[model samples]
Target: MSRTFFTSDHHFGHKNIIDFESRPFSGVEEMNAAMIESWNSVVAKEDKVFHLGDFSFLNRDKTRAIVERLHGYKVLILGNHDRGRSRGWWLDAGFDEVSEHPIVYQGFFFLSHEPMYMNKHMPYVNVHGHIHGQKYEGKSYFNVSVEHWEYKPVPFEQIRDSVAADEEQ
Candidate 1:
């Protein structure tokens, strides 16, 4: 069956991100290749991937090329770094949809490009990206950034199960 996945901050072709994020790769090309490999390994061609943003840093055509090589039917939750492009540009680049705000999924989780606050009254977990390697623990929030998820798209089922477990604890 086709599955759903979540990830963010690929930052494709951004040479400086390696140093800024302390990514272990020796260079941007290697980092980009590894990330693509990791993503394709777990994501089937028909899977739905919610990319929580900062998806790429390359020029328009180059970014589109990278997107074309990626697996899955992708949706983008626009991040701070996702500027300088029209919505049509993102669609043309291969995203099925793009949103500037958070979306609540399956009635139990809030999906967004940036972390959001959830209180006991909200009755939903906040699943987000943007903090990269850091995460807020012992709370109803989860980070799905590439830096924290081994540079691969994490299945939504896994995240849901994790949230369930957290709720129980």
Candidate 2:
């Protein structure tokens, strides 16, 4: 069996993620390296990772190079920033799928980004990125940005109860 992990919004080559967040990272290269390190630290050969969205910046080759270094089978849930050739490049990088709707794995919903409003009709609690908790308050969501400029995977057990409850509705 494979252990599944969820995370989003790495923005690997985006220098602004550090400046806007007031992170200690000095440059985009450092930030990207940190993300790769953080990911590889937790990821193992038998693990599966779901990257919700905004995996990289404007450069497809940069994104592909980073994705190639990370461990696990990556599944790309395409985000707003992921467009055009970037999508295809991501597939080539070894992502299992790229889509708009939620990708259910182990009975939980895996979505690239979150919605502005709540979805009462849906049965599953959305696991997303897009809006970090620092920007949006009281959403009961998790952020993947760890240690200023890192990407960490969050397990389903950490937030499964709430998600499962929502799915039952």
Candidate 3:
């Protein structure tokens, strides 16, 4: 069976990555290339990847090019930055969804942006992006954290252990 992965917040084409605290790249293109490398390193052609949002700083055509270069069947959870251009770009790129809210997959809640509050939640864990740098740390009602531009999936099981460790400390 193919693996299902989740990640987000790769602001490709944003030139000030090094200006940010936790971002390591010196330029946008460098950052974009690095993200692509990281993504392709682990994701296989047959895998399904859930991208939580803030996909690229590139426009629609560039976005399609970048998406095409990557491996996997992508599912987009649209972020605030994902406005304008063409909605068809997303659909044609093989994204299964492009909504703003939660999408369930294999008993997990997928979101592009973070939830406002988690007063009442579901049994499965919630995975999201939007926050980057050191801001990606910490705990919430949701049980997962796949934020930042690292472009790697953090499984629900791993996140559960992270949360448990955080609670113990």
Candidate 4:
């Protein structure tokens, strides 16, 4: 059976991101390789991965090469940095699907590249990326940025359990 995972803000070839996010890698190459390894370690070829945004800063060919190296069927929710290319471009780059805007998954999770406005009164939990190491308060929001997840994707069940736990409080 295939499982779903969420992650974002890889900034694959962006050297500045290492310093910007206080990533521990010595350089961009190391950061990219380590992230790829981390991703493949948990994600299998049959899994589904939703990449929230900022997948990479490399050129099309380079980006495609990196995408091809990862495991799983990938979907991309266009991030602020990803808007430079067309949807078709992302698909061609190895993503199975691309969404230009936020989407609701499994009826309740609002998936986006950036955190959407949500609160306790709202019915939806926002699963998003883009703030990197920072996160918003409340169980209604979950940040899956690579920086927060140890450069790996987070399982959907983990998020579900977190929300469920909060609901019981």
Candidate 5:
């Protein structure tokens, strides 16, 4: 059966991101290859992946090539950096869908590239990316930045369980 996954802030082909995020890879090439392998390790071709944003900093051709190689029906929610390109540009780059704004998913989850405002009193949980290694406090927010997930996509069930556990507390 196909599964759903979430991830963001890949910054692929952005050499400076290695130092900025304190990523372990020696270079952009290594980081890109390792992330590709890690993504494919858990995501099958039939799976669906929601990429929160900042997918890449490479040129169109390079970015498209990387996106084409990943395993999933890809969806991209525009991030701060991603605004440099148009939605149609992202579509041509291989994403199956593109959203310029945060979207409500599964009724209660708010999906966005940047974390949305949330509180315990609120019914919706924010699932987002963009801060990289940093995270907001509270169970109402879930950060799926690649740095937080060991450079791989996280299954939606994992996010669901985390929220459920937090709600119990």
Candidate 6:
């Protein structure tokens, strides 16, 4: 059976990201390789990944190559950087599906590329990225950004446990 996973902001091949974000890797290659290795460590081939956004800064061919190396049935939730691009281009790169807006999955969680703004009255927890390592005090909001997750995709169990812990408080 295939498990589910979530993550965002890999920014592969984007050398400036190291300086901009102060990532610990020596350079782009190390950053990308570490992320790839980290991802593969937890996510198996049959898993399904909901990649929230800002996946890579690489070109078409590079993007295709990177996507091919990743494990999972990847679905993309397009972000600011992903906008104005042809959906077919991303599809051709190996994403099984691409969605532009927040999607409610399994009727339990709201998903978005940016941290979704919500009031205390919302019914479901929001799972999002793009804020990088920024913290959201509310238990209802969970971030899966690479910066927060050590450059790896978060397993479903982690999210589930997080949600449960949030609910307890």
The lDDT values for all models are: 0.87, 0.66, 0.63, 0.95, 0.94, 0.88
RMSD of 5: 0.7
Cα deviation at 46, candidate 3, in Å, is 0.4
Per-model TM values vs. the true structure: 0.95, 0.78, 0.76, 0.98, 0.98, 0.96
lDDT at position 90, candidate 3: 71
Please list all clashing residue pairs in model 4, or write none if there are none.
none
Candidate 4 lDDT over residue span 1-169, tens digit each: 9999999999999999988989999998999999999999999999999999999999889999999999999999999999999999999888999999998999999999989988569988999999999989998999999988889999999999999999899
CA error at residue 23 for candidate 4, angstroms: 0.2
lDDT of 6 at 54: 89
lDDT of residue 150 for candidate 4: 87
> For residues 39-150, could you state the per-residue lDDT of candidate 3 as single tens digits?
8888888987777776777766787788888888887777667655355667765465566556865554435456444433334445666655435333543422233435
List the lowest-lDDT window of 10 residues for candidate 4: 115-124
What lDDT tens digits, residue by residue, belong to model 5 across residues 24-133? 99999999999999999999999999999999898888989999999999999999999989999999888899999998999999999988878669988999998999
Total colliding residue pairs, candidate 3: 1
C-alpha root-mean-square deviation, candidate 3 = 3.5
Clashes of 1: 0
- Model 1 TM-score relative to the real fold: 0.95
Number of colliding residue pairs in model 6 = 0
User: Over the stretch 1-169, how does candidate 6's per-residue lDDT look in tens digits?
Assistant: 8899999988889899888788999998899889999999988999999999988888889899889999999999998788767788889878999998888988988889998878888867888988887878887788998988888899878898988887887
Candidate closer to the true structure by lDDT (higher is better), 1 or 4: 4
Better lDDT candidate (1, 6): 6
For candidate 2, give the lDDT: 0.66
State the local distance difference test value for candidate 6.
0.88
